[model samples]
Target: MDLCLFVTHNCPLGCSYCYSTPKMDVNMTLETAKKSVDFALSHSHDEFQLSFFGGEPLLMWDLMQKATAYAREKCSEKSIPPVFTVTTNGVLLDEEKCKWLKDQEFHIAVSIDGNDRMHDCCRTYPDGSSSHDDSVRGAKIVQAYYEKFELVSVVTPENVNYLYEGVEYLIKEGFTDITLNPDFYSEWNEAQLDNWTEQFKLIGNLYIDCFRNNSPVRISFIDSKIITHLKNGYEQCDKCRFGLDEMAVAPSGNIYPCERLVGNDTGEHIIGDIYNGFDVQRMVEIKNGNGFASNEECLECELAPRCMNWCHCVNIALTGDMNTTDGIVCFHEKMTIEIADYVGGVLFSEKNPAFMARFYGLR
Candidate 1:
């Protein structure tokens, strides 16, 4: 089971596409955090992940520290080693924090849009000042301490054209693992969609070139799809595993299916509270009514097997209906799958023996 603990909904960066309700000054208490951890440990049989999430989890550093200590102690008592991860905006990270996180072996994910202009356009300080430089510096510090970390860059129509450039910038900055995701809920017009498709193709070609040259970078969005296809023939439902095997606990101990639905007003996404435990029936209903199950159009589409459709949370955010598929998101997914197929063909061809050997770990 994967437990995403929304430690706090308070953040310093004013990201334009931020989905969290950051105005609420909510922070998870140590007591609530411990209970949440206990709930996860009890429910999960063998292994479970404890993910620290927030408007910026680092904002509640003290609470985070306490929660980590408590979780470690409880996991030790239960004879289970805990897995830790943190997703942050990387604004408040310092040398000390970086070293501590490295020592603790936390899988860190830093949010940065791309280059300064693209990142600062959306991710800025409350005072409207740029946070790009500081965020990059933080990423550098974390990378210096830990060899493996992920850079998550959000792509909006405003910055979609610069997708390749942003990825290249991260690579130049010594980041090997990168994820570029579109602002799923944003309204993308025809031109933006076309541009996004072209940019994706360009990135795919670049990725292939890098692999051919023996210097491979992992672009999570594309690489994951390719890997999944190779492993299972196609991508499955891109649903948020909320309510099912995954759960997101708010600071107030309210349970949600995922963090994106943490502040939803409809109340339908709230399965149960940590104290009361998950309502099994509600969880069943959620799984039964997941995005893949509800969208008949998606099921019938040729790309359904490999397409990375929006999750329920993103579908709800984009179309105001969990079952409805966003046209732009659907288009982007198809484009991404097509590009992945092309890259797979190139990498697996007999002509590219060296690349294939390297890609398959034979090298």
Candidate 2:
């Protein structure tokens, strides 16, 4: 089971496209945090993942330290190995925090939108000043400690043109695991969508060049498509199981199916709390009703096997219904597959050793 602890609903940066906006000063108490760990462990049988999430989890740094210690001890008692991870905005990461996180063997994913120009397009301080430099500084500090960490760059319509440049900048900065996430909920007209498609093609070329040069980077958007093709489609383990196998615990101890669904913590999505455990009936209702089985259009589509429309959280975010998805998702998937196939064809024809070995087990 993957238990995500939303340590706080407060953040330092004021990114415009932030879904968890209206950042309040709410924080998780130590007791609630410990209870979250206990609840998750009781449900999980073997290996488990404990992720620290937030409007900014580092805001409640002290609680994180205590909660992590409690979780490690509990996992030891249960004889279950625990995996720790955090998703941060990269501003709070310094040498001290990075070293501590490294010592603990935590997997970190930092949000920095490519380069300063692209990042500052939406991400900024409360005073409307740019946070790009501080973010880059923190990311560099983290790089020095952990051999590899994830860099998540959000792609909005405003920054669509800089997609290739932003990734190029991150690659130059030594970031290996990079994710370019498109803002699906935002309005994307023909012009922006066209630009998005073009930007991806450019990045696809970059991906090819990098692998050929033996300096490959994992860009999730492009890499996932290639992997989907390689796997013949997403495996059962690769898909999101909603509230069944994973759940996000809010600071208020209210449980949500996914972190994206934990907005304000006052919605119908509340499945259970840390104190009482999951509402079994509620869990069933969500898991059954929110899959591809619920959408006839998706089930009939040829691209259904390779598409990402099965993610309930993303569906709910875009269309406010777990059973429905938008044209943006459909369009992006088609473009990604087309580009991935092209890239794969080039690498295969050339018989690139790394590509052949990875996908075909050919030396």
Candidate 3:
């Protein structure tokens, strides 16, 4: 099981496309944190991950420490090793914090859009000052302490042209695990979409070249798709055990299906709370409700079997209707599958047998 603790709804940066409403000023109390941890621990059997999430989880540093300590104690008693992780914008990271994070064995994911100009375009301070330098500095500190960490960059229409540049910058910065995610909910015009497709193909070629030469590179978007293609001809939504295997806890102790569904106001999405436990029936309804029965486009498409439709949260965000699929998101999904199939076929057949070993880290 994976339990995400939304430590707080407070953030220092004012990224233009931020999904969380950081102005709400909601912080998870220690009492609520303890209860949420206890609830998750009790339900977990062998191993479980405790992910610290938020508008900026580091803002509630004190609460995070307490919760982690409590979780560690409980897990020790239960004889289960605890796995911890945090996803942050990298503004508040310091040497001390980096040391503590490394000591705790927390898998950190830092948000950096790309180069200075591209990153500073939207990731700015509340006063509209540039956050590029500070963010890079923080990332460097974390990297110095922890050899492995994920660099997560969001790609919007405005920055679509910089896709290759952004990834190149992360590679130069010594990051091996990188993820460039397109903002599916953002309005993408023809020009932006065209640019994104071209850049994506260029990046795919670069990945193949790197693999052939045995260079360290792992782009999550492309790599995940390739892995899915190799294992199963396509991906399926039911394989995503969100409400069952993973859950997100809000500041008020309310439990949600996932992190994306945390701040959403819809009452139907709230499966259960720490005080009451999971609503198994509601969870089943959510999982069963995510198939192609509702989306006519998916039902008729050739990729339906291998497709994982826009997640319910993304669907609601883009269309204001959870049951509906967004045209733009669907377009990106189809393109991704097509590209993954092509890339996987080329690498599997033409490349050296060691290519898969190197790509998958068995080498």
Candidate 4:
């Protein structure tokens, strides 16, 4: 997990659930980007994920081009991990950018809520017009070249009932791999447990439906659990690439733990200056002590062995305590385990040994 880099904080959409809401800053300069990449490549890791995140990555394609070139130059010096991916709104991804993405071997994940109505409900241009059309067009533009990619739908109260409908639309659009993560902006409470249960029920049924139809899309969190169940892994703790295993460099040549933590009033300083050659000592200090202490829950969870604590950024934003509202998240962990156990048994049971064999490598 080298790090997930956020190219800039400039976004075109006015998504209501933008967790980085109050933290949104302006564009990162091209000069700063070059230096940050320099530091990152200097301290590259094997199997690293050089995730390009954004307001929208295309906004700084010039800087990204430099960073990509820097990665190649340094990796040629010594072996490093693959370039992980870029997650975007898919509004500006064009044919030229698509070619560059394929050339760079970058895995892409686009954010699309669902159909035009549901998507527009949350996703809109700063000008307040519907962004669904442009985003879909951009996605179609990228899909012309890329066959299978990742998409995450941010579910909300308004769209919770439409989970199945959204899945249907995504499958029809030719997406083979997709991930559904419900909106976390909604505060956590025992009262909302009913809503959580009902929404996740839709999510579970969506998986069953996909299997029944042999849908091509791979739902992220759920599919991950399926792999985990077969692999004998217990919990699903994958989070933002930047959270646990990743770091990020803003355009100012300042490096932070991840983009989510960057450009915010958290008063967390930019650990290192790429131009100053990545103050390794300072970065280590920031990455180790109080700054990183917010991940204590992940460090102490019983599931820590398998599930890395997911998102400290969101956890901190929602709950004043980093422990997740006195382990409110544990409910989700419990529910996921229950659901995974049920679905794995029903859909990929010993009776359907072929499914299990293909999916889990179990005979």
lDDT of each: 0.80, 0.87, 0.80, 0.65
TM-score (all chains, Cα) for each model: 0.92, 0.97, 0.90, 0.82
Best first by TM-score, ranked: 2, 1, 3, 4
Superposition TM-score, candidate 1 onto the true structure:
0.92
Worst 10 residues of 4 by lDDT: 285-294
Residue 13 local lDDT, model 4: 83
- The TM-score that candidate 3 achieves is 0.90
User: What tens digits encode model 3's per-residue C-alpha lDDT throughout 145-234?
Assistant: 987889899888877777888777778788778888678867888998899888788878777776676674888767767766656634
Query: 1-363, model 2: which lDDT tens digit per residue?
Result: 899998888899999988777888888899988888888888899978899998999888888888888999999998988899999998998898888899889999999998988888899987889999999998999988888889999999999988889999999989978998888878998999999999999999998998899787788877788889888888878988689879899989999989888877776688999888889898778866854634677778887878888888888777778878878888888999999889988988989888888778898
Per-residue CA lDDT of candidate 4, range 194-265, in tens? 666766667677666666665524666666666766666543333343323556776555666657666542
Better of 2 and 3 by lDDT: 2
Off by over 4 Å in 4: 22-25, 45-48, 81-84, 188-193, 234-245, 263-266, 269-272, 275-310, 320-328
Candidate 1 lDDT, tens digit per residue, 94-130? 9999888877779999999888877877888878899
**Local error of candidate 1 at residue 128 (angstroms):** 2.1
Regions more than 4 Å wrong, model 2: none
What RMSD, rounded to one decimal, does every model reach?
A: 2.3, 1.4, 2.6, 4.0
Q: Alpha carbon lDDT of residue 114, candidate 4? A: 75
